[model samples]
Target: MLRDRDNVFCFTANNLDNSLSRLTFNSCTASSIPSSTLQTPPPITYTQPGLYNVYFVSDEGLPTMQVDCKQIRVLPQPIIEINNDTLICQRDTILLVANGPNLYSALWSPVHNTIPPFDTTSIRVHPQEDYRYNVHLEFTQGGGCAYDTSVLIRVSKVFADAGPDRFVADGAYTILGGPRMSMGQEYSYVWTPPTYLSSIVKPNPTSRPLDVMAYYVTVTNDSTGCFHSDSVWVRTECTEIHLPNAFNPVSDVAVNRNFGLLNNNVVKLEYFKIFNRWGQVVFETTDTGKKWDGTQNNIELPPDNYVWIIDGYCVNGKRIKKQGTVLLTR
Candidate 1:
């Protein structure tokens, strides 16, 4: 009689007499075996772990029969357990663990950015994109058994682009456009240097900066907590030119009554001219520092509205022209 751990078992009988007519066997195990006329019995498999009894009978056709009985025991197979699958952001790491009894060796298939020497029960893995990892376990010393399992990990990529740099007039209010990004409706936007912005939390905000400045926006994934940032330069241009409405030549020695450029951006004055009500030129000058003192050829003009036109160039080499009516008072 013999006991074994494996589920399948084979039995054989030997005798000197070769005239054996028939042979039959019966077992109390969960499965049944086929009858055989030869000396070897067919193999049988047991489903459950337990003790089993077998009875055998042989007939020689001479009114004589031989019978034998035996008892055998079977053991259960080893069990394997592994962790469940998961999802993570790009460039992130995750741990994989496997559990088993009397484990001789373990291996992970489809090699990736894993910690070196992946024979241990636990390992750290870094996958660039989505991947599936397989774990093969073996038990050789005590009981020869092998098992196979796999786990899937999904990697999501987060990216953001804040469009391009923009140019606007100085001290002017304009709408700042937002960036084009992926993973729509799953991200939040925030603008930095919120002092001159109409809204800080919105993707597109209004800005009115007094000088040249740079702005930045950060985009974050709400579910994964992944963030990316980009900047948009708010380049300011010297496009503003202010003109005075009225000036006084008499009793105003301290203040110049000249109708000249009032902005600090003008670098050179191309031409300046004054026109009366009948479209006749009264005063004209090509010098930027020269002023119209409400006089024509050194004569005090009357207190009436007069049209003035000024053409100049800014420090940035941009052409500028301004026309307005100024009131003169004696």
Candidate 2:
């Protein structure tokens, strides 16, 4: 059965016994059926449609009669084509490729509910939460049956712990830890130098120097909703500076200036010589806070016990020389 209008081709063959209607029924011969035996043959037009095989010959100088076979099958119109969809994180495997040409299986609809029964076309969905995926394909042509189309897969959220943030300053105290999640997911921190000092015990931390701190940390992905955060700012200072045993080198804002706590970026004084224990030379200066009133050479020395030779520059630029002994109290 075939029907078309315009280029005209209409066929309906039931039982036409003409025996061998003197050959020449062309279907354009490249062998796709219809070859020889003409009575009234001239009607063929097919743009595209299935199964077709028709060849008949009963005599044409002998060897032109090879039975008579006829089979023209063309009834195809069941389309369902889909390819390319991806979401593979932590792997639940969603790879479905459908091509149309006479299919016979595939049905998957997941919004969360699948363990072992969805009738495959390639579906492995074990999404315990957050989901969207649909599929339906069942095609059979010859008995006429068709259904195919499905697209929806967006499962985004994959974070157990996403890196970088660490702080440690152990002088007045400050400690923090990070980038943690591998099956040891148990974290809770609500800290901002609160609790009067600071305490974070899920990764261990403690800090309080004078408490000039602003810190934030929130990490919670216990089962899977994904969470990660970090923040840091700790500036606490009281770092060593205590020197004032006795400074009365004749007060001028009370002796010398640079008795202590004068870090001109880690103070640098090279050779601040001063002697006087009968070794002469007193009240020298390397500009490291030059001060020595019980002088000599400028004359004023008599209460002796001063043999100082201090040279300096410390902290990562190291250079220090010492030969101390000082007490010229007059």
Candidate 3:
């Protein structure tokens, strides 16, 4: 008998006097058996594991009968258990264990370099990419048996890249964006030199730098504890020049009396000129502090529209030119 296995038992009878005889068989621990009383007994099946006994009897033409008995033993089946599936970061190591009774040997398929002792019950794996591992178990003691189980170890890759540089006007904000990754998985973000930035810990932050500067961001994967960094340049644009459309130097003393630069940082004042309606050079000056007071050649000009042009350079070596019309009121 075999434990946890299907066993069949058959019986035969011999008649020495050349006469027809009847045969019968019975078992005390058999799960199933046929129901015939002919010269030969039908097959009997034993499913459970244990000790059993069988009895056989035969009746010939004579008054006497023959009897026989036998005993058998069955063994239990083998069981296998393996660790559950799990995830790991790229280049990360993990231990896998298998349990069973009388485990003779084991085999892991889809061999990898990081996995050692591929034929043992336990193995250490460091996979670079996603993989599915199969474990084959064998039992060679007491009714030998073989069974197989599988486990999956997924490897995630990590990466990070901060996007291109950006330009924004002075005192204006610009959005900073880039790529950030960890172990090809989720990660946290951190931007260095956080001056003029809205937030340093966010992926995309707003920056309004006072001067040109380079920004760096570091990304760390949560799972793998790996880190990567990238940089982006934030350039500052020159300040713009604002010109007055019409300045009344006669009636407006508090404002519009002079037509000149409105802001500072003017490196060089090339020239400032004023023209009348006939395109005549009414007034001109190379001094940045010079202003048009509605007079030319020591005479008060008439109330009319006039054109004014100013050219200069900024501190950043950028050239500037501004032109517009002004009104001289009575």
Best lDDT goes to which candidate? 1
User: Which RMSD does model 3 reach against the true structure?
Assistant: 11.7
State the lDDT of candidate 3 residue by residue for 199-239, as single tens digits. Answer: 98877788867678798888777756756677889887766
Task: Candidate 1: give its CA RMSD in angstroms.
Answer: 11.9
* Candidate 1 positional error at 173, Å: 8.8
Each prediction's TM-score versus the true structure: 0.51, 0.29, 0.44
Backbone Cα, N, C clashes tallied per candidate: 0, 7, 6
Candidate 3 shows a clash count of 6
Ranking by TM-score: 1, 3, 2
lDDT of candidate 1 at residue 259, scale 0 to 100: 68
lDDT per model, in order? Answer: 0.72, 0.49, 0.69
Candidates by lDDT, descending order: 1, 3, 2
Question: Candidate 3's error at 19, in angstroms?
Answer: 22
Native-referenced Cα lDDT, model 3: 0.69
- lDDT score of residue 91 within candidate 1: 71
105-130: candidate 2 lDDT, tens digit per residue: 87777536455566766655645344
Model 1 agreement with the true structure over 11-114: per-residue lDDT tens digits: 54545565564334454456455455655454565677667666666555545666676665544556777778788877788998888778878899777878
